[model samples]
Target: MSGDPVAGVTAKTFGQLPDGREVELYLLVNANGLEMTVMSYGGTIVSLKVPDAQGNAEDVVLGFDSLEDYLSPAYRSANPYFGAIIGRYGNRIAGGQFEIDGTAYQVPTNDGENSLHGGDRGFDQRLWQVSAVDAKDGVGVVLSLVSEDGDQGYPGQLETQVRYTLTNDNALDIRYQATTNETTPINLTQHSYFNLEGEGGVEGQSGILDHILTLNAEAFTPVDEGLIPTGEIRSVEGTAFDFREPTPVGSRIDGDDQQLQRGKGYDHNFVLADNASDAKNGSDAEGLVLAARVEAPQSGRIMEVYTTEPGVQFYSGNFLDGSLVGKAGQPYEHRSGLALETQHFPDSPNQPDFPSTLLSAGETYKSHTRYEFSTR
Candidate 1:
């Protein structure tokens, strides 16, 4: 066992809701002294402490200091999605409507005319039930929630469980599982804006645009002015979206590209390379392919994303306009942190060519994404 003061799983009362429900924070530490703090509210990752090349550890995830800040009036509107679980549907559903089993449904539209990240009140804003688990490789926590049939204009009573395991090898493993009593579409993803330079970067010390990024994707889904996918899997070749090679995030971020103008930055989904490539090499494990690899040059901090999801959304914190201050008591500015959300493609239900996100009553939906941290 680790000799750290916050080793294993420790729970503390974080805050209380308007209805008298108490929110809790679970702290998990590994033998290497890497710490992970998660809150019951939204199953949010409050902080993630990772080490630099010189063994200096710092919190690398962007988040608020207290539950009150997360519950403030501008929390949902002004703040970019940070360190929370996005769900029901992770991305946009065109027109906020879709047909499932010949029945048309309309969810709440929060992003213009499209339904974004579930709705006005997503799983990210909910209070989940938390429990500590003693797993085979490491200690972790499990957060579970139940969404009613008509809760978010979805036709199902869905039960979800998200397990966050911090392994001794410096990996934060996020596993998600869901079961529904009725037919519905389900896509859950973690929305943690990462700045490898640590919380200091989030405090406006530096921008994440200098981080080196590489995505194992040859194609990406293009979007319209409303930021909804245009039902096309366009090639990234000869385009700024190309990240098959390690490239500085700011190299072409300000180019005069229509897609870039639509998202205001990197806010599109990259379709991951097929698992068959790794399967042929006899290295495919649980179909977890390398989604993205990021490195902070100055800090020598690296984060590799491996997941079973088909696509990864690269959001460059375009909306953070220095209005809201973070835990480090500094305003989170634009391009301060980046989010690589691994999930099924956006508007999959509306796009027949895309992979399906449907989960029936008799079937179980399972997905896992691992964030492996190291100094390179």
Candidate 2:
């Protein structure tokens, strides 16, 4: 049973993997009636229920109802990293290859010629261990996992932990921390497709294409045909990529811009103007810079993204295709939802000009991101 809404953590066995390993689900609810359910498998947020303008709560994140669906071959085969924690690298690495300390390494080439979201089997597929739980400021669960040396062709053993905290202020705070035994590349992020219209999953139930979105970026990293950064940071002045002001996502999504055509939609990363270097330099608490703000007029739900990362990837869910069914047997259609992934610029390993994602021995990698929900 849920305790006082102020802060609490509840756990139960969710399901089992093919190998018979057991997985657990933790429910964290805050004072404002915001509830988040996370699972040990992939450290995923299976559901996030937030109150809307009328004070009615609904799940906003796209996911399934049963753990079996998540473990099924069909679900696994078609997963778009829905509600999972992405790791090792959150975005693409050109040609599935990179050089670290003069050593070349090959990663999983799951995305055309590039490696995406940590390769063929990433942290999203791993079973993380719950290390601690606290319900002070809010209900917080700390999930830890250690990626073995050379796992998916990366270097060193990376010991990482992600803390999911549901705050009384209706903020879902995700804090990432990691350390490696040797020099390696590390980028972690949450991959949640949110449809502020509420996770109805049925056709016409939600369409993020019309959601008003505002990104705090003056520039963006353009991509090539394969969606890999072309090593150039260009201004978004007159381009459709300009999201400096609040604009409907679909306003120019179908424009004749070459970049829009290349991505098939908005899948590019916007370079954040606010500097978060102070946080990376080991500050205990760093101010989370506003990255993006999205609002769904139909439901009157608003979500503001804050992070300490250098960039945010605004994905318009261009590939959902309606083949996969979600919670309560709801069919997920094209552009039904969207993902705002906060992280370092894509292909940072290959782009020396971008902020480095490399982590050295004895150096810790820390990142903070938050999604604050509300109603207008």
The 0-to-1 C-alpha lDDT of every candidate, in the order given, reads 0.88, 0.87
How does each model score on TM-score? 0.95, 0.95
The true-versus-predicted C-alpha distance at residue 170 of model 1, in Å, is 0.3
Q: What TM-score would you give candidate 1 relative to the actual structure?
A: 0.95
C-alpha-based local distance difference test score of model 1: 0.88
Clash count, predicted structure 1: 0
Poorly placed runs, candidate 1 (over 4 Å): 1-3, 202-206, 275-285
| Candidate 2 clashes between residue pairs 3 or more apart in a chain or in different chains | none
Error of 2 at 160 (Å): 0.4
* Worst window of 10 by summed lDDT in candidate 2: 276-285
Candidate 1: Cα lDDT at 318: 90
Q: Across residues 57-152, which tens digit of lDDT does each residue of candidate 1 receive?
A: 888888987998898888767746679899889999999999987899999999989999998888998999999999778779999999999988
RMSD of each: 3.1, 2.2
Enumerate clash totals for all models, in the order shown: 0, 0
